[model samples]
Target: MLATCLAQGTSGSPTVRVMSRDTQALLDTGSVVTLLRPVLAGGKAGEPMEVACVHGGTRTYDTCHVVIRTPHGVFTAQAGIVPNLPVPLLIGRDCPIFRPNKVWHVDGYDKLKPFGIAISGCIDGYSRRLMWLSSDSTNNNPAVIARYYLQCVSNCGVVPARLRTDCGTENGDMAAIQCSLREDHTDEFAGPLSHMYGTSTANQRIESWWSIFRKQRTQFWMDLFSDLRDRHYFNGTHEHKCLVWYVLLGIFQKELDEHRELWNNHTIRPVRQSLCPSGKPETMYHLPHRFGGRDCGFQVDPQVLQEFKDLLPPTNSLCGDDNLQYFANLERQSQLAPPINWPAAVDNYLTLKEMAGL
Candidate 1:
């Protein structure tokens, strides 16, 4: 059949046109079409309908709306009928999802602060021992705890995310947990509220609120107590006083200086140097001498000379003149050569007093 290219300006580009209405009718609706015209509510003639059609290649007819496979019921749609055209698209789950009704809102507390806190560090300090804090029903050890925190922090960054405590008991009672989950399931919070599973990204917004909470805690509780303790005015009820002070400090003033520094120097700064396409610049900084920092010079353990030799590249350990010369230069400069027996040499050259034997 012959066709004409119609330039539809609104939709853009060239639109093809067929020769006759009979061809358009055949393309729009096939034979054995079901009558969905009456089934659709508020649908009128000439309205666009969603026709679920199958062609003869897949089915018996050249193109038919009758669905062959139906587990629960038969599915059919009439030809040339418009589908449900809700003005605004509904943006929510269509299915009745079971969400355990458990909504848990977790806020961290760092014992000595007025503000809630969050930390990406292993709940238990991993460097000291591999122990983790056990708030969940799962078994926890130092390694597990450290790994858990490191994994969480590494995935979410050093900035703490909203922590989740499972609260599942060994008794197999999920009611209390479910209740807690539902109560905290607000629009701002997610948990059993929608089909969307819980993720760390959702808690990122609340990270900004941490500094404010920290400031309140620091000023009223820890800082005050720390100052008092340093001044030696701390009495028996110092802890109690700090707690009372925190409670009394009703107005909280956020620490803007540190937050501003972090934003300007770290958070918003652009990185220019990179080792590879994806390698990241070091984020954590430590004092060079006072604390452990990057070592510029190569250091080798004297006891591991054999292992070091094993680790050396073949070219580095080669018997060639160039390699030998390079190693000799390095040994002379670094003063790190093969072990020498200083005791035998020293024994021959006795001190004046020893030689005199007085």
Candidate 2:
């Protein structure tokens, strides 16, 4: 039976024969050239080609054309033959098969966990200025994210040359608004091309800034939350989570705003490798010409901006209406003052949790 299954290929066929279930392929973004096993190439004759390996070594190998089939479609590309390749094939960035499809999965543990606060932000790619960093109940809502973008445009009175963001469904409204704002502009980056969507990793400007943000601010809150969980002061219950958000969201937002202000005013030292202006972010953003940079912001029409704003749904409360009202009532009955700091917030969270019998 095994011999008959292996012998089902044409005698002079140039295509490789392999069981679909047994075949393995790797999609590598770091590699510049695709690779295939010589055995999988069906004994095709090829010219010598020099190929670089991930181990920082180079080897001359024969080249061949590889055909890959997937559920979506089929792709053919030139590949260097790697005789001892662990996988049957390796598709690299040089091939058309490198297109990315992102999927989000939720685990059972994650479902039981409390939903944390969501943050939305944007930055000037040229001056490296912090545009807006805001916290909300949910950033996944398109209206909430769009509101942030629109608010930024309204305050600045201009739209950026291009609005780049990750390919998340939450960004759909913002992308539409950006393209619409630049529709009539004569600039090269206009209309539908005004918005660019790619993976979060590719958006280095904001991605790198998040590291600084976590170290300086969010880390403390994360530690505090972990401490709460460990101490049995806060479980991942819905009511407990809502209480936490109600008590701490305002304080968190206040601290975030303060940090944003300080970051914009702080002087950044010159780096030889960086092309961005090195002075205060606020100055670089406002007066780009002084730093040999151009302000690529496009003027936004007030009427059009308002029209887009009107289409957005009203922002919902972080905790639902019943929870918000119940928590508010509990605070009123207990005569507890609103928390103004982390310590006070923690106290309020515990006190409310006990009152709600959670």
Candidate 3:
């Protein structure tokens, strides 16, 4: 006996096969339209529609409605017919199964440490634009992360419809602030719901960006630090770590700023499967309407933002005060100028290390 059920439609119509245990479905948030194979839609073609593909091109496909039964409930969804679809079903963001909430993804990268550096970043999910990318001694501090979020809001003159982050203690202050800011709003995603906590793996937008960041930027820094460790110049001592932070933090931040500029201005190639727009991130973010996207940012009053900023903890230094002062004194005594480049930074690091008897 066949494992799948075959249901008969009206007379002279092809039979529809119900989904079986072996059928595969993909939930793609990046896609704007749900899709189904012709076989799954009774082998009948509906009206024709032009859809964008991954290769910066468009393809015409038939459209139909399919009844999807899930453990949660059963619903009918409009789907395009793709003859060569790898999966039986593809669910996109436009489906009713997903909440229509706009969000910003926030996370930290600790991959650069021992050199005493951390990276905190936020990206607008709608445009995939980097809102802020900051390098510091530590990013796991709640106050520090909150400040970054608020600073971005202040600069942009708007707040995201929602904020999404991992369920880490480091996100506590940010979550609280988001809730406070939206407490009076009437939207479904306002109030406590304004901030969402999920695993880092599920934070797809920023997580995806991190891979690109590693390939384009962070790998070089990782290699540089590894080289220093291999040469025994960086012994991983607390004082030595502080020295590295003091000498290289500014340079690292400058590099991060440059990388942000390049990333925002560069053109993103089109992908056939993704429904998100492909263009310069800066343009897409500021002028979303050009690509059929609406700005999901909420305007907040500057005075209200200032009030929240006043509640945040004072900003912390990248390294210990004593260590920074000690290094400054050594530089003054040696009459060596502050580093303007990597070679100068290395020379100053070695000279200071030797002077401090490390």
Candidate 4:
């Protein structure tokens, strides 16, 4: 049966360069379905075919799926991997092998000019799997970044050996995060966490991802944000403002997750053959367990998340680290205080006055 491809080729779509073959392919969003006819590579008689069609399709496919087998990895036009399926292409060895819990790359991306909101995420340096995604109004600040990181590590179940970022304050003082710069001219420990604080080029893994993200998406940001603004929906009431923010966050988050899934499931095709092994990052992350792979050594404690959250300014408060303590105290007090039932309190006040000698 045909499954709709949300993040892949669409009919009448723009020409997109296929990362695997380095050739432009038609984005058939499924307007015209075609079955694979296994045939010779070229139009020559008595000549053996240099390439072959995968020879698999379902009745529901409205478009042709680009299928090919290569020495490095088997590829499907769709954005996913099927490990159990029999395929001719297999990376001879685990590509870009990782120590599993070693390092992570985190970054904030694309501050929308109209709304001033942006997306941030963390990806495994080894697996390249997107560990977390979020939208924030003040994404440039440490608090916002830290909150995202806390969610990331809380979900990842392990603390990385090191984390990298371009010396942006929004990266949050990683609880176990590597610092990107030194202050007061005093060199800090040159350990894993500290080592991550190098030049922007050093963080190419995450930086390159942001490039692909911008190219593939964000072109719609201005039009969508303008449409919302013209309607005056955000100008009417406080409720409207809050509702709009939540709505945008959800919308952006959904898109981010879809793109991330496509990136993670599809086999990573490096621009150069030697940059990485031709295989899916998810495969590298999970498949090792079956073949004498060492168990992940690092474990992140859930309680540690609260500590980092505490360091963040109040979500509603736009404050820097120097002012975080005061704002956090305010946040704590507000949480600790019970809600006042104003009507009952007024009635109690009236009774007390009546009972008095006055």
**Index of the highest-lDDT prediction:** 3
**Candidate 1: which stretches are off by over 4 Å?**
1-105, 111-208, 215-221, 235-358
RMSD of candidate 2 to true structure, Å: 12.9
Question: In candidate 4, what are the lDDT values of residues 205-249, reduced to their tens digit?
Answer: 565566667677775665555565686433423333333343345
Better-scoring candidate (lDDT), 1 or 4: 4
Q: List, residue by residue over 1-358, the lDDT tens digit for candidate 2.
A: 0000001112211222232323555433334456777666753455666664333456777776656664334656566777676556655434442221110010011111253566777776545567788876677778888888888889888887667677788889988988888889975457886676655643544655676777888777778888888888877777777887788889988998999899989998864212334688788778766775456577788888899999998888657899999999999999999888889988888888899898
Two-way TM-score contest, 1 vs 3, winner? 3
TM-score of each: 0.20, 0.69, 0.76, 0.50
Regarding lDDT, does 2 or 4 come out ahead?
2
Q: What is the lDDT of candidate 3?
A: 0.72
Q: After superposition, how far is residue 22 of candidate 3 from its true place, in Å?
A: 24
- Once fitted onto the true fold, the runs of candidate 4 whose alpha carbons sit more than 4 angstroms away are 1-97, 111-113, 175-195, 199-202, 226-247, 270-272, 289-297, 317-358
The order by descending lDDT is 3, 2, 4, 1
Q: Number of clashes in model 2?
A: 0
What local lDDT score does residue 75 receive in model 4, on the 0 to 100 scale? 45
Model 2, residue pairs in steric clash: none
How high is the CA lDDT of each candidate model? 0.24, 0.64, 0.72, 0.44
**Cα-lDDT of candidate 2:** 0.64
Clashing pairs in 3: 53-272, 54-271, 54-272
Per-residue lDDT of 1-358 in model 3, one digit per residue for the tens? Answer: 0000111111211122334323456544435566777777753345666765432457777777566665334556556787777556665544444322257889898788767888999877656678899988888789899989888988988777778788899999989988888888876557886777766755656766788899998998888888988998888888888888888888888988998998889998765433456788899888877776567667889898889889888877756688899989998999998788777888888899999998
Give me the displacement of residue 340 in model 4, in angstroms.
35
